[model samples]
Target: MVQFLNENGEFAVASKEHEIYAQFIRDLRESDFLKFYRDMARIRRFDNEATALQRQGQMGLWVPAVGQEGAQIGSGHAVGPNDNIFPSYREHGVAITHGVDLMSIIKMFRGVNHGGWNPYEKKFHLYAIVLGAQTLHAAGYAMGVNFEGKVATGNPEIDEAVITYFGDGATAEGDISEALLMAATTNAPLVFFCQNNQWAISSAVETQTKVPLYRRGEGFGVPGIRVDGNDVLACYAVTKKHMDDARNGLGPYLIEALTYRIGAHTTSDDPSKYRDAEQVAYWQARDPIIRFEKFLRSQGIGQDFFDEVQAAGDQLAAEIRETTFALPEPELELIFDHVYSEPHPLIEEQRAWLRGFEESLGGHTPTDDGENKVDYGGSR
Candidate 1:
């Protein structure tokens, strides 16, 4: 695996093969390090707040990205302004890095909206709930970019690329396989980023695949690389290089980030039932945030900076909690909206049918008493 910072937060070349990736981080300034640390801390705070909101019944569900911050934030920053990002549901850190409002993600889980941000404006697509489906979408988009004569045009500013993020479990999806084939055949300017967080819900990644995920694309003619997902600098370097290569008209590349999921797969899962304490404790010791902090301290960053980040995180938590509580409940008809870009006759017919059904029910809303209320012809 490509790693610049080890578990001890010491920076050294992992191997000669990874030295190329290490070279990319040579020009990074202290300011960049600080920014990375700040974003990672803030996103963890956001993740914690969202989990709490779910527990309090404020959100319908929550997907925590606690341990994968380095992978998300580092690779998120590596994406150029013109590049498009198609994220799986757990990429809250990536969304924030692209300037997506945290409340938009909150509203999604609050059952208020279908990802409130505009993808065209931010170049960050809507979160994909269907596993690995976005890979095909990203492949198509990159192929479109290729056909438009945008790649390898000798103008970096005009070239465009596409990236899709998914998990280890998603690698088993046929959509990902088809996407790889299409990208390779068309030489699409795309990069496949996989955060192998070790568990597919309760299924271990080891049992899910026969080979390392990075090699999964090789048979399709798309080369792959493995990176230390917890090493923020390594992720940034490797992703920046691959993405830049993709934008420069190199065909699709795959990056498998080896990381761990520190929390349950979702708010509804009980990880303790499937995983042991020792495994969790082992990963906890290599916590990305704590490791990065150690690296920063070595560079003369003191307690004051750490304290400031903590204060900022606390303030962020408070602000998002307030925002989530203040969110307005979505109308019952919202499901009918955004089914299509423009109004369609079928949608209108279905919507009208729903409205008629609601009217026939006498506008009676469901109660929270946990009892099934059946409205008979003339009685309850």
Candidate 2:
């Protein structure tokens, strides 16, 4: 695995094979490190707040990306402005690296919005709940980029690529294989990033695949590499190189980030049911945020900066909680509003059925003109 930082937060390149990846971060200033720390801390705080909200009956569900912050934030920052990102449900850190609002994610879990952000504006696509499905969407988009002569355009601003994020479990899905085949066959400008978070819900990653996941793409004609997902610097450098290569028309590539899922898969899951305390403790010691903090301290960062980050995180959590509590109950008609870009007979029929069903329940039904028509069971 490619690792630039050890568990003790010390700088130790793992091997000569990945030593070259370190050069990508050679020019990073102290400010860059501060930004990285700030973003990681922010996303982690958001995750904690979201989880609390879910437990308190404020949101329906929450996917915690606590342990995977290094992989998500590092790779997210590596992405270029013109690049496209297709994220799985647990990429809150990646969303932060882009311009995605934390409230948009909160709204999604609140069941009031379906990924409120605009993908075109931020280049960050909606969260994909289905396992491994975003790979195909990313492949298709990369092919479109190739067709439009976007890759290898010499102009850095015009050249583009696609990066799709999925977990270790998603590798077993056929959609991932099909996407790999498509990208390889077409030489699409895409990078497949798989965060091997050790567990797919209750099932450990060991049972999911026999071979190293990065090598899984080799048979499909796409080369692969494995990086120390817990090391932020390594993750950033590896993703940066591959994404840059993809933009230069190097075709599809796969990066397997070996990290751990410290929290439960989602708010609904219970990790204690399957995982033991010892394993959890082992990973906690290598917590990404804590390790990154060590590195920052070694660089002479003081307590004041840490204190400021803590204050900012606390303020953000408070704001998110307040906003979530104030979120209005969504209208019943919201489910049918964006089912399609254009009006369809089937959707119209479904809408009418819902309207009638609401009326039968002695409830007010929303009208097209934004008015609520109260049904009196024909008593009036």
Candidate 3:
């Protein structure tokens, strides 16, 4: 794996030896570094809270991106405003980086909304629950951008790129392969970012592929590289380079981020059932947040700074919890609202039948205020 920072939280190279990757790091101000840390810390806090909410039955399901924060944050920060991002279900960090409202994400898991936020407004698509589905969407969008003569425009500001994120397990899906073929053949300005977090649910990476995931991209004629997904600096540098190349009309690229899935695949999963304790311990020792904190300390960042960030993360978690609880229960009629842009006769008829049935029930009816009223043999 390409690693700029080792597990010991020390740089593998001196400052002067940054070489080609220098452009990505050199221009970064202190605020940028702190922002990366803040983003990761805040998302992890939110992830923990969301998991708790799932256990308490607030959400139907929750996917935790616990250990892979570095990969998501670094790559997310690398993208420009002109770029679009298509994310799989677990990309909370990326969504947050792209200015997505955290409550909207929570609303999605709570089953109260179908992706509550508008994708166009943030240039970030709704999370795709189906494995590898968003890859196809991203490729199609990139192809459309090319068709519009947006590629090779010389002006970096005008040329756009597309980035789609998926996990290692998604690579086994036929949709991913087809997306790769489309991107390569069409030379679409796309970057396929695969966060190879070692495990696909309970299946290990060894079971999923005979060789490294990055190598698969090469067979499809797309240039691919592996990066230490736990090293934010490396992830940022590598993704920035490829994104820049893609925008310049050099075609698509693939990045296999070698990280670990520190938590259960979802709230319903039990990682302890399939994985050994030693493996978990090994990854826990290489925790991205811990390593990054060490680097910050080495750079003379004080304990006071870390404390302030902790407080901020705590505040964010509290606010998210409040907002999540405050979200109004989705009305039963909402399911019919977005089924079709233009109303269909069959749908309207079914909706009317349902409304009448509810009204027929003595204790159930629509109130004058337009809210549903339900009483179980009790006075209203």
Best of the two (2, 3) by lDDT: 2
Candidate 2 clash pair list: none
| TM-score of model number 1 | 0.92
Error of 1 at 54 (Å): 0.5
Please report the TM-score between candidate 3 and the true structure. Answer: 0.93
How does model 2 fare in lDDT? 0.91
lDDT of each: 0.90, 0.91, 0.88
- Cα TM-score per model: 0.92, 0.93, 0.93
Better of 1 and 3 by lDDT: 1
Residue-wise C-alpha lDDT for candidate 3, range 203-263, written one tens digit per residue: 9988878878988788788988888899888888888988999999999999999999999
* Cα lDDT of model 1 by residue, 89-181, tens digit: 999999878999889899998888888689998899999999999999999999999989999998988999999999999999999999999
Clashes of each: 0, 0, 0
**Highest lDDT, which number?**
2
C-alpha lDDT (0 to 100) for residue 337 of candidate 1: 78
